[model samples]
Target: MLATVARPSPESDPFSPPGIALEASALMGLRHLARRGTGATTRGRSGLPGGLVTRRRGRGTEPDDVRPWAEGDDVRHIDRNATARTGTLHVRTHHEERDRAVVLLADFRPSMLFGTRRALRSVAAAEALVLLGWRIAGDGGRVGLCVAGAEPLALPPRGAGRGMAALCQGLARGHAGALAAPLHDDPPLSPILEQARALLPAGGHLVLASALDSPGDDFSERLAALAERISVSLILVSDAFERIAPPGLYPYATPDGRRGTARISGRARPAPEDRLAACARLGLACLRLDTETGPEGFAPLMERLDAVL
Candidate 1:
């Protein structure tokens, strides 16, 4: 069974920087994609079988709660009798909103260790979790996470706080010990992806985070199959620095503790661009993360995605 992992409280997170400013910037860039005069139900394209939930508007009700009106306000829900007795205008405020279930898949293979950045891609994946989860959680949504590698770690869907914590713990672990060993030879990612599919409460969203480092074509096909089942967003985290490293030139240590450098031309892998293009072809919303750029560049990326999702 998938479980939630413990994480430091918001108070203890040293990097718990205020998200409001950053979120506001992302929202600003996303405003163009916003629909104003249209009815609440008409927001964004509908997805999947259930269609979508619509919002009802009234006088005093704000999409994001601005303020209360004194008098002469739209009395869509006013009590005429009460107004006569109280001699004051009264209005009800309603928030027109909907929630999206977001699934986060993190790839924690050993290859993530090869990064020019000190924190490594493994650590960088955790940071991406916070950024992506922040937006979804801000809108009162749920999040599920899956860690892929020789051993896959799964954290079933949970509300914001617990889900984020669980993801962090999953990323911190090197690999699954016992429960994941049995599936090593032919580990089918289908079960986990199906779990993700089940968690998306009709009309929800999905986000898969990975380095695309695993062997074979299983993960790719699994992801394509997932998109057909549900709306998915892919955040592909990769280390560009690794592509430039010369082969055989890596430092190698012998079993006896002796260390030497070998000239290996095949050590380096193909460019991340190819993998990213493949994801785009799969019709998944792709977010390319790099250590050099950090999460600050997420503003524009989310802007483009806001329209699609």
Candidate 2:
């Protein structure tokens, strides 16, 4: 029987960001292990082919690969087969198989920092990156990360314990560095989108964590274009309270770094649902993580999604 998926609701949702969760250093470690998806779609109902299901190497370690021993290499894990194949001892390097590849596009615009709840959208992005990397790495799948800040950075996918550490560290660093820059500006998505398209291999999945507040509308169009090349998952982070805030006299700041004031006398209009619907029409899996919820709230949703992908 098919399992039912729960519909999203204000009361039922759990994906929220705490005020402070992921520190900068941890993000740097994550960056090293990050890689782009191959843009490959998942298989249909037929399931994986024969011989693909192999035993796992062990906890927190990947399978092995034999290579010729270098001068200063560790001799403890030398393989006998390679010693026989060649006339000398060869080091056995255990490299895990990457069954699935995930690319995280973390967006850290200024708008993401505007939240009314316990945490900002930026916190949600960081948490998602860390949790996703840990879970994916634990499963022996290759994980990669991409940052769409005022500056762009891409971490290639890797399948080793060392690689995972590097990925985490990189993401942590990116998060810290991103905070120092101005968030509002029109960035050309063509180069980054092209890079994303080229990096994602076939059957790979792409996860974009952003607030969708770009002014030029270019990023959204580029995202839609990328979806055609890969299995795209859109994680839109927002604060429910801010999304529905009532209009009143409030202090405000303009995007150009100026203080301003505006009179909002009534309720703000709800964002058009059609924008999200169009994303669905493009075959993108759209998920919203409201900042008002709580940190670690989206872990269950991600766990459930890990299976479906």
lDDT of 2 at 100: 61
Over 1-309, each residue of candidate 2 has an lDDT whose tens digit, in order, gives 000112234675222223534465544443323322211211221122111123344221453567788787666777788799899988776644434677767765455555556666777777666666655665556667777665577877665566567666666566555554544453544455566555666667777776666524566677667777777777767666546767676665432345555676654433535546666777887767776665346665554444455
Please provide, for model 1 over 121-220, each residue's C-alpha lDDT reduced to its tens digit, 9 standing for 90 to 100.
6445555665555444434457666766655666666665556556555654533232222222334455666766776766677766666665345767
Q: All candidates' TM-scores?
A: 0.58, 0.64
Supply the global lDDT for candidate 1: 0.52
- What lDDT would candidate 2 get against the real structure? 0.57
Q: Tell me, by TM-score, which candidate is best.
A: 2
Identify the runs in model 2 with alpha carbons over 4 angstroms from their true place: 1-99, 186-190, 252-258, 265-274
